[model samples]
Target: MCETNHNHNIKLDKNGNCNTDEHKTWNRRSFLQALGLVGGGSMMLANTPLSVSRPSPLSIALSQSTNENILVLVRLQGGNDGFNTIIPVYDYDVYANARPLIRIPPSEFINLSDDYAMPKPMNKLESVWGEGQMKVVHGVGYENSSLSHFKGSDIYANTNLQEDDRTGFMGRYFGEIYPDYFFNPPPSPPSLQIGSIGNLIFKGPESDYSFAVSDPRRLLQIIENETFYNLDGVDENCTYGEKLRFLREATNTTFDYAEVISAAYERSPEYTDSSYQDDSLGRQFRIISRLIRGGLGTKVYLVTLGGFDTHNNQIQRHQQLLTSFSEAVSTFYKDLAADQSEDWAGRVLTMTMSEFGRRFRENGSLGTDHGTAAPTMFFGPALNGSGFVGEHPDLNNLTRGGNVTNTVDFRQVYATVMKDWLCVDEGLVGRSLLDTDGGPFESLDLGFNCSGTTSNIPSDGESLSHIPTYSDSQTFINIVTPQTTHIDVSLYNIVGQKVATLANEMLMEGVNMVINVKDSANTRLSTGPYVYQIKTNNGDYSKSIIIS
Candidate 1:
């Protein structure tokens, strides 16, 4: 049944879709090679088998699972400068001293309480803040963080430090939740990335869980012409031809999605308001809003906006990017909250990511260099999104070339969203996200009422650093033992509710152990306020932690 159809007087229309031959290759591999997506999207083209060895993902939603929450993930392709973006009101003097040229003027910032402030460009988000739907998780990074764009992004995407990995956090998490995705797809693609499809975030073991189209119209053109890149009954005998066949088969599936996205696009209304910027980021958010409003059952959505890597002429460039970012988010929220679809305001939680944050000190170019540890944000109506979470950035003490040490591990955020928001099972959380050598990261309590229940996870602790604040996201509980003694460190809210037990062990004499405190369901702590107590043979030492 396989035949070779060479490129000869190929008849086609405006749209790129193959009309006569839907299964022949008119040099499809060459087209893919040009874009560099084969390796990124498919991973190992010839090496890895079509199927992977793992448990079936069909039964991911167990009986005790929480309600399915929609997560809108956005990635700032280039490293973002957290210091300039999130002004350090607590240490403005030091921050200003560090970057006199690049530092955001105090007056040009929106003060978020007494401790934190954001640049004026972020001022428009005041409404989001006022609604308590803007939360800032300070100092997000991991150990041995990479400075290179490729390496750092891989670290965040894979959550694993391994270099040769194509498996992404979203891919694994979604894969488990919808094990039968390949055989029985979701109502819509489980996750839809607006721009490029070279991302591995939604990659599955045997196949990818998401779809890729540079532009809906481009795909539509390709489909409208029925110019499907056919692989001439791809014969397995020819490796290149066989590969083309495989890609052709995948492209056929892509045709299926083109129709779906086109429908969603048609359903979305035009933006008549002036709030939305006429920029790319704005356009992407606009599409996302329409898709979600159009009842796309997509559980997770990723929207990426690059140009954050500000190495030169950053003042204008950075401001523009932030402005676009803030406006896009604000406009998206407003659009969702409109009378046409008011219920989704709280239903969708928008979170941000970056490969890494720029160096603490400004470089000679009046810009910032790639560094470690930066701020990540969570915004939406449902979450108590206001207030700063995690340890505040310490400008005075910079590490390994003036980089801010991470206070809260990024994986904790994923864990929180997965367990608390999406209600994914604990086991999948471990298998999906990589944080402490493939760990089930301690869930951070973002103060979201996932099941109409109050969380009491004690907030972040602010005191002298018992443990030099590293890039890891764990909050420390310093305990110095005088003699061989048994100690118990317990977390509690102001109302005397025992929230969690950080450590319960017997220590040898004259030993100090720094414990990490995280908020989870069992040890629920709200974002408002909380306290912690450590009981030992020598007596009890207590400290306070502010969760928000």
Candidate 2:
């Protein structure tokens, strides 16, 4: 709704000529018409294809099918600090020395194992991590990663390291499925962007395959009731007339899209997922979840959590962003579970993507500068690869470029998703990602790793498999689960003073959890008489562990 600048003192006639009394001023409509004819934008959608009335726009899944692979792509807008996000347990000293100003203190680190630990703020993902539902792919980047957010994001989205292609990986996928999307859009909306459509990540060869609206309810109101008023008659034979016709026709198609989106929104369930973080990200995911729960048949969804460009005062801001993201994502999965959707856990996959990562060393401004490789995380019920995927880049030995060298090619990830999750042809996936040579890029193993079980075991059947062995370095707890839920355990001195919080996490069912315990450093526990307790969602259980 940008207004065109015009000279205010001039009086003009209806024909856009200078006059004396009445001024027929130019406005948005005429400006749009001018653009329509001048740029010939109307030619883009000249022929309305017959399939506009198709069941859904670019429909890929059957409404009654429960096995469709659903992908929830999360864009981390700013460069994320991979070192801080996934603390390096092996190179703690080097990492701390590099970013002393913004490092997470050793004492406060949450122990995942002797090899790795996450920031305490990441505790929301503890349950997911424990169940092997999360995968941390480290050192994800392309060669010569761009430092500029705009350029880096484009590279990531376009998957064109050469910066030569205009089509994104997803865009190409959509284009392959719906060759003439401009003329005959899917019966239902193909892809949905929760908030602003930040980029053309979903742009096809000739047109964009997705649509975005700020609010569903408001969109419904606008499409169903709002009216557009065009100006009165002018010359029908003039250049302006033809341009006006194009603009009006384009306007009509836009209205049609609005109506389709509103109908899909109405089809979504009335109840919103309540576990969200009550922020923009949360609100957006809520919309996504309801659409899935209500069976909208949308194949792709784009969710964003921006403000990652932490060039200054990053400690608090980064933590807040991670917290919001963690809570919303963790809860979104749970919300799907609460709905008791049969295939949600197995069908829906959520992955995080970023433009790039910050430098290893802290800058003078108390924030790390933009740099290269970072970790990408994935969570879902059908995830086979959990924990760390690639070896963490050596902090002591950085590349000559002063960045963590990529351990996993970003295209490998794209190829994996295309083939494993979205079921694209392997040959198409390989070319879509790595370009001309290969038929299928190496697919990362993201299959469901844990065993499925019925959650009907009796309360008395659950217990610690054995007394956990403890030392100053660590402790091991073998907790057998009857069902999947929350579990917390702690150690106490002889006098009942709590010594260490060993495990406060969610555990999946039907697995023996060899839980590890450690303080800040990867050291064993002290020798002494200690008592341990285990708490489950069902009830509390306790045992003794004599480290001596």
Candidate 3:
């Protein structure tokens, strides 16, 4: 008999084993809701709304900028059993003894080298490896890893091992590149997130940098329909009717980026190749491929594949998941390669990440529990060659908790990718990764090296800073200039109309200027949301404020 435990959100049998078959019956809406995609941000895309942070004029300007390389983050939602995924050919005896029931037959796995092999279910990756487009980083994790899935995922995304930090490494990088993010967002999304709804990887200090959607079908509908929100049916007789109309109109105008997204989708050729699977992950990759081919200049994308939490029926369940993942990734690369003119395959990199690895030994239930460290896989022609980067953890040596000790710090891989593949400056990379105090982590040699790349970040002595503060029923724009330069500060409404000129004069060097918005406007202001923009010779910055 099977019993549901609402507290733990799982189903268990009389023997206390997890009901693995339940995963097979999950519908799209239930799966997405489980992933926490129900709320926050704006509602734009179809029934399943797309979460989006309102972009500023500066954001619009930055979106027009372009970068050569792109990154695709494949989030393996649950903890993957690494020992099963990457068989230890060198230590086969020890591995077999550890998981005798779940041990893969020697002949069943595809051999990569004398030291390691991949399960047969992932045979599709053999071609990717043979083409010199795939590489694996062994035992990639942080020290003192958290076994809890929620905490582990947060630690990996934020790159902070000590405590729960809301900001992510990518978010920090985006924040640094676009300091005035709250005021001026980029033209296109800085990143596009397709699953992993609640993941903090793209969360900036004040707002999330990515435009997120729960599923590809809704995103497709958005592109096809080319409409954000309909305000026609709103009843004027309803309570707060004027406010309701104003809110809807404001929301409709804010989603103008939907038109931009639709234009890009329309420009790309229709995806007619049926070789790609018609399942969840495959459909996601198909949409991503279209966006990339259609000239959507988003730099980073994150897609997810769950069901890695195989605590029961390990053999059948794991095989199915791996098979799907391998096939989807294989077809995604082929789809990109179809565009011969752009060399899209050579410019894009795909990386896989999980919260953690599973226990080194299989449990009585025939599955492994949450443990530590796993292999991180990278795929793309840009990798230049195929091979393993770190020494595999010794099977005989285990921690007190029976988990594999990490041989490579995951942050090292992130630092290397940010510095080399993304062409970010070494100094900014250190700051973004929060390793500035201890100095930047050592970057690994992952085949390619950045050359002739110059950073656009301004020096500390040349940068300007602004802070908006509310005190005693008055609004203040506190400006700290690095050196005296002409400054112009203005306020605008939700509809992009200038409402007040807060400041339009020159300030002295090393001076701190604070302007009172209410006194400076020279008119009575209503209570609502407003954007205050500061224009200086150094650069432009803006942020939103709520007047209540």
TM-score of each: 0.66, 0.65, 0.77
Which digits, one per residue and each the tens of the lDDT, describe model 2 over residues 1-548? 11112321222346665322111233322354345321111111111101111122212221111336678889888888888888887888888888888999887687777877888887888888887788888889978778999888888888887646666777765654443344333445556665445355776564455432334454345576865435355232333343343445445455566565445556655443655677878887776777677676666778788899999999999998888888888888877776664656567889989999999988999998898999999998778546677767777777666787777888888788766666655655554564764444676666741123211111223433434665554556677776786888766543344667777889888778776654421344444334456667675555444443
lDDT of 3 by residue, 488-531 (tens): 98887645668889998897777999888888988765555567
Against the reference, the lDDT scores of all candidates come to 0.65, 0.64, 0.73
Per-model clash counts, in order, read 28, 21, 7
lDDT of 1 by residue, 233-296 (tens): 5444433444454456555655655555556656766543356788877877777777677665
Ranking by TM-score: 3, 1, 2
- In model 3, the clashing pairs are 56-185, 59-184, 59-185, 59-186, 59-187, 63-187, 183-542
Greater-lDDT candidate between 1 and 3: 3
- For this target, which candidate reaches the highest TM-score against the unseen true structure? 3
Candidate 1 vs 3: which has more TM-score? 3
Off by over 4 Å in 3: 1-54, 60-66, 171-187, 208-246, 270-272, 423-439, 448-450, 454-462, 481-511, 515-548
